[model samples]
Target: MSKEFEIVREFEVDASPEQVWEAVTAGTGGWMWPMEEPEPREGGKGPFGSTVTAWDPPHRYVNRVENVEDIAEQSANQLDYTIEPREGGKRAWVRYVHSGILVEDWDNQYDAADKHTDFYLHTLREYLTRFAGRPVAFATFEDGPEASKSAAAFTAVGRALGLADDTAEGAKVRARGPEGQAFDAVVDYRNPYFIGLRTDTALIRLFGRNHWGYPVGISVHDFAPDADGKANETAWRGWLDGVFSA
Candidate 1:
């Protein structure tokens, strides 16, 4: 039972059209996971083995893939990005559309996608505003098995980080992780399901996926020149283990 879903979003950020294009195609690691660099022309390679359907530098890009067995069952997946420069090329407006088919658990999948889109776009804005052009080492961590089953998993993680439910964006935060990893950061983005912290060297995202019946997760986009993704993952996993065990 396949179902179609389309998500459309339009937002403005402080980045030039070129910058936005680069971020989507080449610099995804700053906000999202590292992706295979897409070839810059139509009919060329795209992320996740998708084919480029349309490519117009700094303005429009589209890619599509079909029947990726691991991702969908006999489904079409497409991503379209439209960027328009504004304010004398100092900023840009972006229109992003994600259309696809879900083969199972449609409601949960759609809900996750919808909320994740908001978080991703917010992170993109944070990247452009603060860490544009910096290389990123991305890493992710998930809640321990026991914690994943707990409805309060993310709430516990938040408490461990000294975060209150009303912690406002842009508030400076200084907290120590379970393993004593310190954060001298500013809250860049926050919602009931996600929270983002921006430190001098990293953009850290904490996911409250347990709210959606999944394990809570953490993603780090470390921008320091010497950042090591493996090290970051190991450290965070240990921290998460400590949180769950406590």
Candidate 2:
């Protein structure tokens, strides 16, 4: 039996996609370096030669990882990135798609495959996920408008990510809490051919593009932090207005 496993992880990065891409493809020196022994390039004699299937510039990079034939059957990895505008400028989300196949000898590397993939991602995520040893946060989901929100003790601020019209897709909602604090968070995505972007979700027509048109941007917003130290829209927004619009 051939068992295939697919894993997809999406992240909202504060900086531009280019910046995040650098940290991701920034050589194999970091803790969670995904590349194995081969130096990643397509059909070339690098460390990851045979396993490293493809490399398509910034957007979509891929990996055809294999471990000891009789050991792990076959493995495949996909990387996708895109930009979403919030406030005004830009933010990005890097969607990772990794999957693999196990044939003939399935049980041999069943569990190992899982572990290997986890560690592999952990490597890349550790770097692009954070910088200067600080853990950054991204919005996975949201439920309100970024414009009209309470900013009393919650604190809130606003900034233009850039100039966006239709490509700007996101949710906007304002909800009050009965607990410690209140806030609003926006989860957005941009699929336009912006100056520094790599792909556009709307034009996800071309097949090869999927492999190369990874996101150039991913962003998250926080307006405040509640008693639990989570994003409190009111407070965070206030802070943003005070700090940036000064």
Candidate 3:
């Protein structure tokens, strides 16, 4: 029998409801998620052609997908965002739900979503907290066949960049990989949770988290112009896969 799966996440954002709403609905360049922005109206088109089922400014927005994209096994999915005022209007409470039906490989699909939700939400918080109105471009790279979802993945990435496990903020980092992939940056923020690197060309963020008892995966965000993003994405994707496999 086909089964349904739902993933829910809630975040306390240090921004007002209006701010959060604007950030969520504003088209590309405002936030990192949604490869493309959906028009904010009923029946408007969303990422991967999802339809906007409901749109209520600064309060509730819903998107439903009848045909899932990028995944052949999953047929349907929906994303819902509920924003509420909190801290007497100084902050916002955000709830996110991603649900769908799975007919095969449910474990892997669910786990992937479960792990990725944290990174996505974290990215949203960072955008709202620091770069709300700034012009930005976000790029994502997926690991290749050599990728590993293990505890040592994080250390491997740091080492690939010539950084120690305890690398701290302000530290200099240089990394090189296959296909002429290279990065030079100074650590902007560092902690066990996440690491932010700043270069002359872009702001890069790396996340390390365990999901479902295993290191989920590694992702790098390049908040820069799109001119160089495609090449960077290809390079980083191959480099990360190689690092984890090593």
Model 2 C-alpha lDDT per residue in residues 135-190, reported as the tens digit of each score:
23322112223332233111121123222333233443232222323334222222
Ranking by TM-score: 1, 3, 2
- Model 3 steric clash pairs: none
State candidate 3's TM-score: 0.73
- Model 1 lDDT per residue over 81-113, tens place: 999989999999999999988888888888988
lDDT of each: 0.85, 0.36, 0.69
lDDT of 2 at 98: 58
Per-residue accuracy of model 3 over 30-88 as CA lDDT, tens digit each: 33543667787888987777999988888999988977878776888998999999989
Clash numbers, per candidate: 0, 53, 0
Which pairs clash inside model 1?
Answer: none
Better of 1 and 3 by TM-score: 1
Model 1 regions more than 4 Å off:
72-74, 142-146
Candidate achieving higher lDDT, 1 or 2: 1
